[model samples]
Target: MEVEKARVLIVGAGGVGIMAAYALEVGGKAAVTLVMRSNYRRAQDAGISIDSVDHGKGIREWRPTEIRNTIPDVSQEGIPPFDFILVTTKNIPDVPPTVADLVAPAVSPGHTAIVLSQNGLNIERPLLARFPQNPILSSVSMISTTETSPAVVVHDFADAQKIGPFVPQPAAEAAARRYVAVYNGSGRLADVVYDADVPRARWHKLVYNASFNPVAAALRMDTARMRMSRHVVDDLVRPIMLEVVAAARAAGHVLPPDLPDALIRVDPVEAAFRPSMCQDADKGNLMEIETIVGEPLREGEARGVPMPTLRTVYGILKGLQLQTKVAKGLWEPAFDDDNPYR
Candidate 1:
């Protein structure tokens, strides 16, 4: 059977969402829409741009992109339903984090099977409960792209995707042609990884994210610096990666050997790259400390695995993130209402 063309709705016009839009626009992959909850005025100011900060390939070109939102606003009066929903928000959502709930009603089971492309786990469980019938695909994205504007998002690296049906969906040979279409159309990214064990890939990315982002955010250094510095890795990162690996094994996934070493060996081009955690901390926004760092530590304990290094990383990174949040006076957080804005 020929797959029906999908109407893509990308939530959160941050780096990932915008890049998804760029991918669609470049590929003309599917009819795409961009929905953002914050910095919306900016979206209105400058629309989607395809950007890559790897080596100054940053460029912003406005494609015919639709802008909707998760907050209640004047602009979101009547928008069409979506076939493919890409939720790019964080697993550790900011206060009043109800956008996911609100967006659920707008998606029908026939047209909606969301691809969770966030940095961590635990975001989909709650959504799964609410949308019990809708098939939620748990996905892992390994590319590291940076975005500050709607029209421009910088691609940091290229990695494949691992996607599988989660909760009430058939796990078979599925085609992600619509989702993969977007990345390939533009110079945004290359490669779509299907038919792989999603749990392993997700855990793999989680381990890598936990190891680098938190330490980088805490120390305000890029992954390259973290890899090259012996004191940093031996004393800090290596141990954390070990703990994360232990946790993944407990959860029935084992990363490849030499992963800790391989992750550290960065090319000179990427040596100075700041991770998303560091970027969020610097911007005074909430960080995914819990998802990226805490979940593995907790999972390890539940599965009788020892994760001393990860526990320490979680403690330090969570402390730093909270301290920053307190300093900015955005501390007393509230989960957002599930109200669709646009």
Candidate 2:
């Protein structure tokens, strides 16, 4: 009897990362290691859970290991390099910046394929120059999920799909074996397509993210409200979709001719879902504006396409950041002793 031959490293131990780990680990077919920030101690107590379409496909308990901490810099003491790497970090640019500095020293292009389970547009093109030889892939999800607590999550919605560049001619054999290796052994993933229209697949997700995220965060509203309101749909939502479509077109993305129709598809009354931007804002963390809305709008303007709606939303989000800052008081405190941000 032969065992599956692959070593795996997951860059995040957040909800998505741990879910994938459980999928891989229960199959008992792959070696899995998760790299997360030290703050994941919070996750340990939170009680996270995931349910798949198939029975016996849920992670009951997760005792995750921290890949590295105490030193923001990479250390050579432990952690063997792996054959496959899954980057499940936030879509913010800082994540990739940090990953490059931390993981690159231990990882090499040889036998390493990375799957970027991130959101936003144009994330792939930026990494090409440095990891030119490594097979880089992208994935998106329609399900609304959250890292409820380190230990548990209530998966409100569950739609997991992955699509990537057709594992180039050179690494086709290795990549496919590894792709099949995960789902075939684990039974946690499906609808994994490796072919053309991948960019379209990516942009399709961008449309969904942009439509719900900014509106929800800016209005401090939830998915259900935005989906239910005509004011949000006509005034705020549709315009943002237009800007997103413009940006996608400017970037040479292929989309249906009825781009607006494709971009703005929300349930008549939004599902019991919370947008990531809303979640991030509620947590008082840095939101993914720069990549999701800000960057695409800028890209469109740079390419002579107009994204007024996007620009407006970017401005509003920035103002909200300022309001948050003021409330938190990074400035000289009016009340020096107990400044909120302090």
Candidate 3:
């Protein structure tokens, strides 16, 4: 007869989260609710305005079924538990209230599948530890999008969104495939792919993110400028990318040998785009240094693979993060002989 609309709760109101919400609502496949801490009021007032080249000229505005400031707010309002909890926030483990903590309240075991649409490696560790019985899905987005204002977002380009089960359980895989169907049926904005090799897909994306994201933040330049400089590409970008491949191999995920070269040759049209890490740095927001760079470096070290380039870039980005905090008066520099980078 009729199909039931899947209920999805998006935990973050950033670019990715907003984009996912827009896609789901537009597709009519899910009843979406967004937990936007800062933009709840604005989103409720004006809805979300998406200026997307992928979606074309007119600004697409969508109001989810409800927008609440927090998970507790949803519970207080008597909203039902979400069928899926999609986390599109940055993977900052050191930050208080980890992803697991944020989605714990609304998670229904066996019913709710936690989808982590984030960058970096081993991101599902905490969630797996916290909710051992729940189905966890790892997702990687190739789309370029940015939230320009409280209620306005800009989508530059979208290549694909790959998803797979984090733990390889049948229930988890089924859940992941169902989520994929929703996106693929939704005008193919993401060009969703059911990646069987989750680790390889993660490492493949890491080859690009681990190399460019930190470098862009450290150098304070966009991708176009970074790619334009041969010295930067050869000396910095390519080196870091190779290190990622090495690290991935050491961690038992062997990526393509030519992946680094392919990543360095940025498409001229999307060249001007700044990665999320660089955008976060520009706004004095904390970058995902530990997750995006540090975790892989640690993995390599554990596997006896030396990632000198990744290590150096990780240190630089961490130092930049500390500087941003100090400038914001959130942290004070300690006058000690010990090197914080070390």
Candidate 4:
């Protein structure tokens, strides 16, 4: 008997989303449908072109089985309910459409598995609350990818994608493993691992993101400069990481004791990398401040864990974001008595 292929709906067309689409297509194990709101015409016309050191030298293109402009379009085009829905968009809480809203149209409450392939802490809370019966999985990736244009992506370095069940149900674990198998079967430079300790894995990745992303974005420098300054790494980076660990512990996730030191030992190659937050700052785009930093700070505050370092960094990033908005004429600076930073 022939096996039925999994139907996947990828909601974002950014670097991570395209990379996942490429892998699933190359694996030939799933029928992938990409929801590219801005790049639907480009992707439909020329497909997605990937230039990667891991995949080869030149530009290679791969088209998903279907490309739609919106989630409602998927059903309107006679597509069935997706077996798996992958959300690779930034987890910004202040954003107009929440992740739950974005994926709601395409998923069946109990039948579809939802995968969040974005950064940050407490990302699954709203999703779990909204879709109580669905298997919600979380993923953390070390890959460095950038979308240079509408249909073009560049993969700088490929790393393993760690996936795990957020709720840890048997069905969730099975779904996570199936997704892992699909990625591993692809000939791309993907090393997918199904992690049993999903929360721990998220906290482990947070150590690096919380430390480096905001610092780099605030200073408008690459990771190389941030890592090169011994004072910066020792004074700023280490403290921020320790605060994240503390917050994780306060939230009931006990990460490894040496996680801070492990995150501090940055690779020289990765030092030259520009994190997503830095890139967004460079382009004057909105950063994922709330999910990446603010949410964790709130967690710490609720648990009575003092996170002075994280709070300080969060304030700086928020200031930067406000300045950027003011510069772009999107915001006006007004004096408010309730503003603590004022």
Tens-place lDDT per residue, model 3, 1-342, is 668889898988888888788778767789888889777788888778888766654564578777888774345557676788999887787666788988888887657899999888888999999888888998888887877788788888873788999888899999899888775556666477787678888888989899889998998788788877777888888888888899889878878787887777765646587777888888888889888899889988898887888888888988898887788786777756777864
lDDT of 4 by residue, 1-342 (tens): 767778899988888888888778677788888889777788888778898756654655578887878775445556677789999988777645899988887878688999999888889999999999899999888887878888888988774688999987899999999988876556554477888888778777888898888988887877677677778787788898888889889888988888777766665655577778988999888899988889888988899999998899999998888887788786788879898987
Models sorted by lDDT, best on top: 4, 3, 1, 2
lDDT of 1 by residue, 71-119 (tens): 3222254555565677777766544555466566566645466777776
TM-score, model 2 to reference: 0.79
For candidate 2, list the clashing residue pairs, or say none.
43-150, 46-149, 47-151, 47-152, 48-151, 48-152, 48-153, 49-153, 328-341
What would the TM-scores of all predictions be? 0.81, 0.79, 0.91, 0.89
> TM-score: which candidate is best?
3
Quote the lDDT for 15 in model 1: 66
Scored by CA lDDT, what does every candidate get? 0.67, 0.63, 0.82, 0.83
Q: Give the count of colliding residue pairs in each prediction.
A: 23, 9, 0, 0
Q: Top model by lDDT, which number?
A: 4
* Candidate achieving higher lDDT, 1 or 3: 3
List where candidate 1 sits over 4 angstroms from the true fold: 1-4, 37-47, 51-60, 69-80, 148-150, 171-190, 267-270, 332-342
lDDT per residue for candidate 2 within 2-105, as digits (tens), equals 77546667777666776666656656666666665653554445434555443234656554333333222223655455666777777665323554544565
Error of 3 at 120 (Å): 0.3
Give the residue spans of candidate 2 off by over 4 A. Answer: 36-59, 62-75, 78-80, 94-97, 166-169, 172-177, 257-272, 322-342
